[model samples]
Target: MKRTTSSKRCNYVLEKLKLHYSGTSYCNCFEPPWLCPEVEECVWKPESNKSKQFTNAVNTWIDLSKKTNNLFIKKQLYEWLDMNHANILAVDRGLYPVERFFPLEKKGIFNTFLGRIIMEILPPCKNTKGKNKILHLLSKACPKRCQIRNLKEIVLQYATEDDQTYLFLLEVMKKSLLGKYNHCKVQLQFEGRHVFYQMFSYQISQKSFFLKWFENGNHQIFLFFCLKEYLCDAVRQVKTVYDYIEKHWKWSIFDKQVVKSMDNCRKILNTISEREYNLLHVSDWISSIESFLLQVSKQHIKLFRTTNAMGYISKLKVNLNKYIISEDLNVDIRQDVSRFLWEITQRTTDKNVFYYALEVLGLEREVVEKVKNEIFCALDYKMLSPNDLFTLKEFCRVIELHKSTYNFVLPKHYYDKQVLSLKKRENKNNQAIGYICFICNDIKFFLTKLSDSSRHSNKLARGSLRVVVDNDISCCHENNLKFVCGKKPERHVKNSKKKWKNDKKALTRKLLKEKQRNFLSKQCIQTPLQEIDLLGHAIQFNNKMIMLCSSCGNVCMLDPESFKYSVNINCKVCHVSPRDICIKCNTETTCNKILVYNQRRTKFHKAPMCNNCTNVYAQKQPVVI
Candidate 1:
């Protein structure tokens, strides 16, 4: 069984070698059986003197040193050197034996060279385990008293005012540790003191070791008592320093001082709870200042020139408004206070400022009303230009300070009446003389009649005459017809049959004629007039049916005397006198003269007088003529 196991192991080794050598070797077949020995014998046996002599002879012929030029061969040689050194180290440590078959001189040289390479590649002691050992040794060798003294020196060196104060408190606490305050014994009192002292002491010790020391040992006890008495005193000092820098320092020194003061405040506050000491008062002031700053930022215009103290005052007013009632607060001081508030309100972008203002107003109605009234009154008198109107409108919308109750000063009707008067003036400028007509109530009607001189007279003339009525039909006396032809003779039928037939034909023709006559009569009916009926009126005078005025040349079918007459007398030639006149000849006379004018008068007379002319001469001309 052992032989079988040995055989398997030998085969496995040979397989691994073959796989590795495949890329480098020229041969394909395994070595011959006679040359390949048993695995154990090949692994265990050293080369005999004769075999070594033979290997030396073969090596001398092959020039094996030439193959050492390859990088892979050099790497393999170095790996072999490393493996050999590792084996030597393992054996020196009693972990394994050194191989005897390997040449002693070559092994020694490889091991030494590898050892030197490792030592060169290794990191320095500062980064290695050597650093830990050095720290361990120093810790063990240092005395506790010496360490405490060193810690004290270190702490004093780095002690800030707050840190020194804290350190003094810690030392005072240590006095209790020495049993000075044993009467104040309580549960965990020792533990609490130890914890408190250790906490501050360690920090101070670390700072002292690394930073400069301050001389404050003389008053250490006194400082401790002051801190204990007024636990927030250091915080107050920090606040004072912060306020000083904020008010007096520029940006260059502001941040540095702020950081230093804040750190001191933080250290002091962290040492005590709020109940023990309200050190957060400084923080509260800081927060208030921050809030003020935020508000001031919103008021970019007016508040831009504000000093820090002014800004702080403004912020204080804002905060007061946030908390205090205006009536409850001093009213005499409110104006100044509100000015401060407004400055901050305008400067800040904070919505909370407005909200705070609202809250204040809610608490103080009279003050709010006064402020609102003042603002609205100012807005009213402010001669807001067109550009400013829109902004003012928006401001009013946002603030809603007042409701506008009145608009333009003038009454609406007054303006309307003025506009109508202007329109009348414009119309007068464009009006013509004959544009208006009292009779027709139309400008165009009068203007059209005035455009023609003949139509003008016709338009003005009124005719009146005798209209003869025979039975119910009215006709002109001149139109009464005198029969020029006698009535035609009526014919009668002689024979009964011939008479009947002829009568029938005559009746038929008569019926047809009656139908056509009736049709024509229906077509002759005129559309109805509202107030006048022309049902039975007919007249004729001279060549046409006409009427004449009895008293005036104003021709009309109805009597001019029956109705009032007014003529639009434009020209004498075309004028028809409202009393009596010959319209065409521009002569005024009695109606009788116009009706019967003498065409031939005395030829040698001063005037040849027609009937109308003679009457006009009698009335209008001189009797001498």
Candidate 2:
């Protein structure tokens, strides 16, 4: 402040410029505080320290490593520095004081991040010696969590058919991830489906690397067979999707894609001859066959051998003795039938919608129930029994035989095939099409062929030549279609005749009602006394003065033909019928009996009582309605 030096003045001017025009002077070309984008960082370069650009980058990385607590950031910094002996020597020779602080094998990065990075930098396919050197470092690495993209890359590019090196490499890769999991133990992706399981899973994916491993792996020569195991898994998946569609006739988009992928994989598999496929699965087949042969040789069957069971065993042996019999065919057929029977058994046990909806056409309810119980009992016994004839696949075969012999009918749903009503037709006429529903009386006029089909009766509108006549009927339903235009059936004609008769009866009733009104009006003026008495009765009698004849102190109408005759006190022959027994006196009486005390109509419930109980009840206090 007393006397400014040149350096202080220059600093003052620079600070003022930075504060006022800082944003204007800045550009994207300026180097970032961390790694420089323009510089090509390499570990092999010895003169990296001598170059100003490289030194600046190294300094920035060192600063970043010191300041950041994040492990991933530190990893990125170390990777930026290109951690290698040559880079280490260059940094040391350059006289960088921070070289000693660099994270090494002892710093926990060795077995984890450093090992993974080293493996990536020196893949076994490219640098086998370097990869081997650091292979020991990966012993502590987490197999399930750690990344191994380089190993997969090695398998894809460098793996050769029957190469010991490739085999050893595959073993190492398999050991890293699939520890203790043998070929049989490795679960298929189809089973145990989970969302997170797909994300981190490095092994057994649809990628080409694993596919190549399967294609190249020699199962016959190696006891640790990789190809045969995963190949079987893929084949099983293909078979499962195919069977559901082929046997059950179920189809879905996802299943279609799965079938396509499996077909592609099968094409790759065909490269290895069918003999190899047999050799791959032969061990399991031989063991099963040996067990069956031993059982037959020892005469294992005793009292359990019924005629049907013996015949089943003979047929099984015949099938097994065929020259073309293979493990895949037998195993697949058995599994398919077992699964189908198991599902059917489960449905029957649960009494699902389909089971409850089952109807027998010509059987009494009792007979149907008994037959159903017997069938279910047999199915339960078959499931529990060890007899060969009752085995799921064998039982299914027996059922098939019986079906051909007896013409056994199955549920309609089981045999029904869903056929599309509106089969899409090509526009050969090159004109717009109109879809019209005569049943619903709906017309989608001048619609393009590409337009979605209109739904009617849960079916799309199909192409058919229909001559529909429009009438006044407003209901958008199929039942009215014949009334509008279509040829009438016998039932429709009968219904029309019945409707005409009903209309005639209704007209006659209307005329009788009008005649009754005119007679009442004329009688009202002619007979004044009757009119006054009737008007008083009509006004006072809210409940039509209807009462049971049994409980009345006076004689009531004996038979009433109509409500008008029953309500008339003068009518002696018309009365409500006495059908109920007396509640108080155990005697026959009318159910609607209401006792009257004095001239006043007492408000009380219709408690059925005999004349003797009514007289006693009249002496006691009357109950209000």
lDDT of 1 at 348: 62
lDDT of each: 0.29, 0.31
Question: Which lDDT tens digits does candidate 1 get at residues 563-620?
Answer: 3332321123223333344433545432332223334552332322335455555665
Badly placed stretches (over 4 Å) of model 1 are 1-188, 198-203, 209-381, 384-625
Task: Residues 1-625, candidate 2: write the lDDT tens digits.
Answer: 2333433433443354234324642212112222343434332233335555544454444444445565443433333332222334444466432322221112221123332333332121122243432332232121122223344334344444324334433433332122112222221111111111221234433345544444454221121122222222222444553354335323233233323333333232233322233242322221222233333224211211112323433343234323112221222223333334434543443533222232221223442353345333332332322322223223333233322221123233212210110112222222223222211222222111111111111122233223234443464344343212222212323344445565887655454444433423332222111011111111112112221121121111222232343342322221222334566667654223555333255444465656666666666766332
How many residue pairs clash in all the candidates, one count each?
24, 5
Q: Which stretches of candidate 2 lie over 4 Å from their true place?
A: 1-49, 70-625
Tell me the TM-score of each prediction against the true structure. Answer: 0.12, 0.18
Global fold similarity of model 1 (TM-score): 0.12
What lDDT is obtained when candidate 1 is compared to the true structure? Answer: 0.29
